[model samples]
Target: MEAGEHQAVQLCLESGALISTQQHDLSTPVHLACAQGAMDIVRLMFSRQPDQRGASMNATDKEGRTVILLAAARGAWKTVTALLRLDADLSVKDNLRRNLLHHIVLSGGLLDDFHGEINERLKDFGDLLNERDIQGCTAMHYASRNGQLKTIESLLHFGAIVNLKNNENQSPLHFAARYGRYNTVRHLLESKKGHLIINEMDGEGKTPLHIASQNGHTRVVHLLLVKGALLHRDHKGRTPLHYAVTNGFTHTMEQLLAVHSHLLDQSDRDGNTALHLAAMHNKANTASLLLSLSCKISHNEQDFTPIDYALHYKHSEVAMVMVTHPSRSEEVMSCRTKRYTCLVEGLTAVMPEVMMVKHSFQALQNTEGVGDIVPETDQPLPVMNIMVRYGREELLSHPLCVKYLETKWNSYGMYFHMLNLAVYTVFLSFLTTNAVQLMAEKTDRENFTQVTSAQLASAFVYPSTRAKYFLDIMNVLEWTLYISAGLMAAGHLSTAVVDRSNQYIMAALAVFLAWFNYLLYLQRFNRIGLYVVMFLEILSTLLKVMFVFSVLIIAFGLSFHILLAKIDMNVKTPVFDPFTGNVTMRSMNMSDKGFHNPVISLVRVGTMMLGELDFLGTYLRPMRALESSAWYQIVAATWFLVVFIVLMPILLMNLLIGLAVGDIETVRRNAQLKRLTMQVELHTDLERKLPRRILTMVDKTEVYVYPNQKGSSSYVSVPDTKHVFRVHSSYVLRD
Candidate 1:
């Protein structure tokens, strides 16, 4: 029967089952059976479920021990054999580095090296032989400790490191010697490689000889000594003789002394002899045996002798023997520093990447684009986050290549410029209209006071002021228009540079410039200029909102006609009609009918009439013809209505409003000055007259006077007279 309850174990096993009938702990039925050392149970479970036996044979148990290791530790050779056959990893170690080999070595089983059955069944003996346990010891160390010669030989033949050390720094040879395993020690020595046994020490800095001496193993000590083991000092500067005597190993001490009696008197690096250490350790018999070797005490170096050390440690009996002999003392040195220099270097090495990451984070916080985050490091997570946050494909394609293109079109000064222009334009328009009105009023004989009004208006004219206002308005308008045009052009250019197309942008800029010119014309033209102003205004508005191409065609036609007529007439084509064989009848017929042609035909008539008529008649005939034309009558009526009715009213209203605003501003300024003067007078009266009157009343009319000694005249005096004389009589002033 297994040690654990079968029902509880069965429930635990079932509760922990996973996929493929595997358990929660990565185990199977065979693992649990082998671990618990139940052979019959393992066979029964294997027979019931053959597939479960092969599930993760390398899986570890709850303690991180493999089932193979557990079976090895329990000496369940059959179970261990079964697990190894199932491909359980023999080299797998627990958390403590205790592999199956370590368990088997510690199990105290008698292993046979020459057994063919054992060798055939255990093919992994070589794997176990080379495996190291926790504290860096191998199975050979454990085998050597238990005096298992055959196991030691098997491990050695299969490449088990005989020189391997444990946590205590003791080799397998040291373990064998310390445990008095003579046969195992002989086997290790026989199979030892170069530098394997020499200079090997334990945790206490003791060679194998020291361990053999401390454990009272005379034969092992003799064996190590014969093999040329050094009688070296440990960390405490104590030799093997010291350890042997201190641990009460009289026979081991005798063996060491027989080899070298002078070794007892010899002091270690600390000037402490073997006798001193023995006396300190309170080994009376070992100390006496050392004292029989003619050991002497030196008085000068006897302070805090072994006797004193033993006495301080409450070993009084040992203290008596230590006081008989002592050795010299020595001093050791220490060196250390407080400043941390490496930290500064480490920070310097990482500074660039750190700064890049910080700047990237700050840039991302302010902007909206995913590609805004720059590539700073090769780390995948940060780059992946950037890609995911900002669409990866979009960022890669058409990356923010034109990030530096200028977007700012205008400055604060540009707006100020516009304001100045509007103000000056309005002011100049007002001045021009007022000047004309003044001249018209002066010419009207029926109007009374016309001269006086003219003089008054002239006095207030101030052409310099008018000019200043006009210049200011022009300055503002000119700069505002220029800046707006320039900005629109630049914006279009920048957009074109970024997008590689300027069609819409150029059209928009052209329209903007045309509109600006329209506004300028509106400001320049008043009543009489309206017909021309309206034409330009309508054309510009059409160009901006509707058909730019149509406007361009009209402009092109007019320019072409004007240019063609400006060419010299000396170089002429045939005047005669080729078909009729006479002078072109169409021109002669138009002249006979007296129907004047348009400007183009008029230009041709002027060319023919230039020498025929005098300059005066030529100009008069053209003028008369133009005046008598039907088109001229229609244009004249339209111009008259637009200029006199529509545009004149608007101009008149603007002039009246400007005059009214000026008058109101003048009145406001005068009132403000008047109020300031009154306030100053009131303050002066309160500061001087009121204070003097109140002081006189408080003094009750009493007066004080001071006389100048040289002139015998009173320079200061208070009023004593009841009546005061006036500079002039009030009646005389009224008359």
Candidate 2:
């Protein structure tokens, strides 16, 4: 029942199972085998049949397609051959009235044996190639539609008609050209009897060239044009150029325009030219090409020109192109400006002021000098709260616009320098303080030192209050710095005790001081802070991958540890010391820390993941000492080197790098907005600190002072004589 199960079919037939059993699709074992191209199963099943005319061999499925017809349609040459040897029906038709030849042609007959076998069967039926289906499509029609060159040649050799038309009145060339089959079109054109149907029209009155041009088949269009296919109009009175322009096929339009330049002005049933169609569809390149060929811009039946069509569809770029052509017709230019001036007025933010108000008022000379005279109208240019922000290059190149230099605000005053100095001084002081203490500890052992007194005192005074503010990372860091400063003070104050605990406390204090100072420095660059935040966001994903990687390492490390546990050899290991000489000790492995235990193996593998592969000596020394298990240890070490070193670290590390690189641009764009947010916060803080009198004196400033009344209905404050600088409202563009 399954595909390629010839043995199962043989076993069932030899055991005398029913040959006429049907599946849910109403297909028998023969139909199923033929569909799968199971030639052996087909032969086995047909050989067990009771007779040639039995119900199973010549049975039609639900769709009325028999076994051999299904095989022929699927191009199953072996299955078709096996059925033909058993005398299968060759003249049966399906629900679509398609015989064996029709199915072969429709399936393209790509296989040689399949097409040849079907063609040999058709020779006994006498001119089945020209026989009509239900839709009146012959085998040649299907061959042409599917671009089956071999099938076409076979049908032609069998005396198939070349100029047969389907029910849609479309010739083989129409179907070939419409589907962009360049080779099939060429083969049809090269045929002696098929060359005359080049311009034959279908039901829609579209020629092969029209269909090819509409589909944007450049090579087929060129070939059709070279073969004398004309650019005739269809039922809608639209030429091939109209179709090309509407579809934005610039190359096809170029080829057609070279021969038929007058088709540029040809109008359709609605009196819309090719330019109108292109503009309405927002085909800027096609519209520009039409304008370059001097296509006339005229109105449609509704008195709408191409520019109006573009504006009606909100295609501003296309409208701008149509309005700026250098060689545009005088009639088009004269009528376009007044008709679509609303579009130019809508671009007030992007266009220059001179062009925006050019036609509104003319210059008049008063008693003083020439100036703009105001004109009265019922509806002035609507106030634009939102406008298109065109780039500088686009505004500079507009024909009716003149560019003006915009004044830019630069933050280079004393306030900017003071903010920078504050951040830099704090960062440098933290580093300098740590360095000075380190030098004093090394050079002067008798004297004690504390870096800063204020930091030392605040550390012991604010432990409880600082613990309450741990949710804020900055607060937590500040408290950590304070506590670390207190710990360092304690260490220096207790130097006389000379305890080892003091050394450990000093080490932890050093780490906290360095981390707190680094965070302080990062807060200064708000833009870089955004990059840090983005990197932190992907930390969870990296940790998850590391979790999986660790699981794998742990599994493999335990395996290697258990396998190489008893293979260690005692050797002398040297210990490096400053006060004493290098001492040697007898150890079972490198550093007396043999990886015979799983925990030690895991630690070694963890270091190897960070590209520390010095454990090769640990594995090699054990192999050299134990000659019995030397080969197994070498294999285990090699596997460790391959998987943990090459596979995990290199490949997974690169994957993380790729993920970080992909998010870099997104982080950079967001950093700009974050920088602006920081600037707004800094400016607000500065405003709150300044005196009210000085804040009132600032230009483009707004002030809202609530009245000091209690339970009064009218609590709005009015400007009194004492605070005389109050204004209603003003706008300030943040620097």
Candidate 3:
């Protein structure tokens, strides 16, 4: 391993004891000498044998590292010079396809005093100074990437191009910026001829500024910015500020923002600003910084705002910051936004045992005596509806409640009443016309049903007609629309069939309106009458189930009627003639009429299921003579047994009972909510009939403060509608 021991190896080689020694990796004696910077041992190995010199000098190790390449890489100046003098080819490369110059450059800071001589020797090859490896990186790239300032200067002095691009189209400046080499980046930018283009872009259109900003290289970012690196968008339309904010480089972000304040609102290809990126990544401090800069929170192409992203990613802290952002707090409390917030917040399930009742907050009296007495109609406020309903009474009187109460009707709400009125008037007129048509039809009932002239004249002449008309008001309207549309369709397909669904819809509308009219009058006792509505809902479900099961009954009736029809019918049965071996038949008079008609069969099956029929008399005795055949009578009896005993009595009856009992509690618990929902719907429909201008006069402003919380609130005052307040409280509004 030492330079002095080569003489012993020479003596062994001369005596023909051995030619050479090599390790498993194929590293020869010359390779070890060159790797260890033993220039004397390398000379001895070359001179100790004549024919071995060529193989020893040019031999590639397992990794394809030649002696001279290793010598140059290890800064073995004498060994490298000796190998070169002995005709070592500088063109030979390692497995990495790096030539001697590439290796020399890769040897960062290792080549100290011999750097000049090595550089001079490698520079003499001319093109080797700029030779690119397999990845198309020149020696200068390696020097720049490894922070070899002196080597980089030497290479550049030897005519290395400062802006030479690699396979990724990245210049040395990109490598320097990415690795955070502040001195190298400065030197590259301050090249004597200004050869380095400060704004040069890579294949991804990213400049050094973007790279440095992304990597949080503060000093390098400053150097690039001071060198007039223009802010340019990459392939993703992201600028350096976008990179800084996305990567959470606070210092770099501040510097970029300070220099380019206009980028505060710049959006990427996704329409996401730096603030949006910060929020999505849960960079709270960065988001706060951007919020402080008054960055506008705009929606992306997907209609997602920065706050939406924050909530979607479950970044609760970031979402809170965005939702409570000072600039948008008032906007968040606007009518449209507040309505959505309240609806969503109200629906979140809290305690399971809480009864289905609306909840309200009880505001404590403030010093200014501004608190309302929390009237029955005006509990805490609609904003506290969810908190009280879910038993989060602590938050019921929070400041957010005041903010929610500040929400007023949007400008569109001003015209909502007018639109509703127009719709209501149009439908009301249709209903009236339908009623008249129905009355006329009834007066002309001779067309549809037999009627005496005396009765018709009485209908035309007396007040009894009004009583009849009022009695059949809903039915008359529905039938009028139905028959009129049908008659019109019969006259011409295009006449009324074109909007047949519309006609049915109108008929249904009339029916519901009649029902709702009763509900409106019963609003005085809606709490008591809501039970009726819940019952009707349950009854409707039962009816739907009966409708479905009725088909099964019809199916079984038809199938079994046809099946049992031949059970005891008078028909000829085939038999064999014993003498001639030919077919013959015998006729029997059978009189089993139990399943003679499908309707009658259904009746029998129904009676049997109710346990009201004597099985022996009704079913067995009727088919008594057929029992001699055994199989037919047995199958028929078994069919009857399964249907009456198993299917009808046990399976279907229990299933119906279970269905009804399962949802009874659900229906009861949801009764009040459903009633409130229906009442709100009806009131909303009626409210839409008011004039737009009148609605504008009515509580268009959002905020209303009581006498107690007057100075504590920060909402614009709605002076007109302040006297009366409304709470969606279950106890006050319903009970």
Candidate 4:
């Protein structure tokens, strides 16, 4: 029937092959034919079974549309007229109690084809025109939902109420706007004028504007705006502007915001403004627009900003927009920029997913806490912990991370830092004293025992995850210093005379190495810490530069040895026995420099690279009389000097100097940012040493402290210990 297969449908009816058959929808041949607008096929089926009239023709399928209703909906005019002539129940409603008009309007069909004849058929049936379906949607609702302008117009002309709401309380205009049916929306507004409920909200408290904006229907959104569809917030407290931003419709957002510009910065229930949604969704253009409006860095209830969302979601483009936003620092912030600002607040989600612990990002609110309340292993490792490990400047520089570290620092950080510094200093002092005793050819067994015990305690206290634990350079250095010191002590107790020198050598190694460990603790001061961090960064760059230019330095060094033969050797000394009257072996002095061999020649090149030109006074002061004066040799010597100077000092040295300057410049610009990052790491190391009682205290989960609070600012969580006691000072003690 749908294929206009009149012959096939007629044969099926005549043969009685499918006359008794029904489809999955229980749709018989005639019902299928009517739905497809195959009036001829429907007629043949009816002709074959004349007795199948009233009950058979009026019977509803699964969806409850009768044959006549379906035919009229499909514009099958002849089928509907025949059904009406057979006294078909025009007043009969579907399972949903929708009459013929509902289906006709929903599917866009001519309802008044036989209006003059049908008027008599339903003389007392004017109420059927306004009948409601099971969903309480009238014919007008369906018409608007289907975007049928003609049907909407005809219904309004026939006294159909325009603002009739469905079970969801969604009016005709609501359906029209939701489906982006601008034509019907315009017709409804034009037809009903003031009577049309343009601003009617659905069950979700969303107006047509919200729906249109969410679906990115810019035209429909404009039409609704012009038609007075008020920008309203839904149950989630999201405005139409929120919807526009979420869908990344910049133009639609522009249209909405232009009408009500003040809602641009208004936060919803979650404390998320239009800008937050834009950043979360990586809508760079939308973010740029929001930023252009001087949108401030408003923190959500979770204390996350738009840039936080951008960084957490790995939206670099969005982050760049927010970071470079002209008003980032200039725009007035909420409680953040105040000089007396206090932080009893912060959030967890910070860095991008690729940098996350599990390689997936989830907001703290969405992260399910472990063991009823303790935000333990299940949560993303504490934000500061992640910052220390992952090292995102954006995250580390965030005020929340900074505030957290500051709070920790001001609370008990100084005490913890001083305690550890005192312990390490004692150990260093012991190591130094033992090295000094060995250097003075003395013994101090008590000092040696103390140093060895500290080393053993350190190794034992370290986490058993050795691969990750030992990866720390400090850990490696600690083991080296302690083991060397122990070996030095062992040599002192031995009777072997040759072991004394080995002991001295080992003692020297331990003393100097202990100083390098002090660099790790240098982060306590921001000025020094930032330099240390920058120095590490610059050192990495320096290594690469040196590695690449090593060949040039060696080439020049070897050429120097070949070009100038006079500066050939470091020293020519001989070890001899006077009684034997013979020289045993030649000795080479290492504390001297000249292009004697490849190694010393390369050393000369390295010295020249560092701007140490010894030849200026020794060789070049007065052109030494050449043993074999040749002009070519003179030219070679002069030209090689110039080439080495150009490559090493002028080019390579400046490059190295310029690289350091550039790093210094960057550090200068982001000095505060770098200090904040360093503080986070320092505090992380400090916090890790804290007891579980301290870690658990605060908001019954993670410990938080307000350094500036009037009273005791820490919210301590009483651990689930069997026996616990509180002292007069409110200090908690547990077994």
Best by TM-score: 2
Candidate 3 weakest lDDT stretch, 10 residues: 350-359
Query: What tens-digit string does per-residue lDDT give for candidate 3 at 1-735?
Result: 545476676776677632255678988877887888777766665566767877777788888988888887787767776666666777788887888878777765334445555555654556677767788888878788888888777767767788888899988889999999999988888887444478889999999999999999988898888888899999999999988888888899888888889999999899989877987888877887888888886777777667666555666555445544556544432312212363124222221111122223234212123233223332223323333445553353334332333232232322443453444344444444443454342222332122122222322321222244456554355345434433422322332443444544544554455345434333223244556666666766778887877765676566557656556533455778999999987653222445677788776566655675455533554455455564465466557566657766687777777777787867764554444433333333333444657544653223332332223332222223233332121211122
Clashing pairs in 1: 421-476, 421-477, 424-473
lDDT for each of the candidates? 0.49, 0.61, 0.60, 0.65
Model 2 alpha-carbon miss at residue 195, Å? 3.1
Model 4 agreement with the true structure over 1-735: per-residue lDDT tens digits? 557787877776667654435678867667877667676666576678776644467667787777877777677777777667767777777777878787667656755565754576655345666788999999888888888776666667667887777899888888887788988878877774534477778899998888888888889888877777766678999999998899888888888877888888988999998888998999978888887777666888888767666655667556545444545522422234221241111112332211111211223123343334433443323555555556566775543444455455656665666666667777777778777777676666676678777656544542334265578776788778878878876775663732877887888887777887767666565456566666666777799989999999888887867765443323335677889898865433222447657788888788777778766443442244333453355457667888888878999988988887766767554554655655655554545555657754621222333221235321111123112211111110111
- Candidate 3, which segments miss by more than 4 Å at Cα? 1-11, 15-22, 75-78, 85-87, 109-124, 192-196, 324-735
For every model shown, what is its TM-score relative to the native structure? Answer: 0.39, 0.53, 0.45, 0.42
Q: Evaluated with lDDT, which candidate comes out highest?
A: 4
Better of 3 and 4 by TM-score: 3
Cα lDDT tens digits, model 1, 472-520, are 5534554444443333333323444323234234324434543454454
* Candidates ranked by TM-score: 2, 3, 4, 1
Candidate 1, number of clashes: 3
Instruction: Report residue 510 deviation for candidate 2 (angstroms).
Output: 26
lDDT of 3 at 413: 28
What order do you get sorting by lDDT, best first? 4, 2, 3, 1
Q: How far is candidate 3 from the true structure (C-alpha RMSD, Å)?
A: 24.4
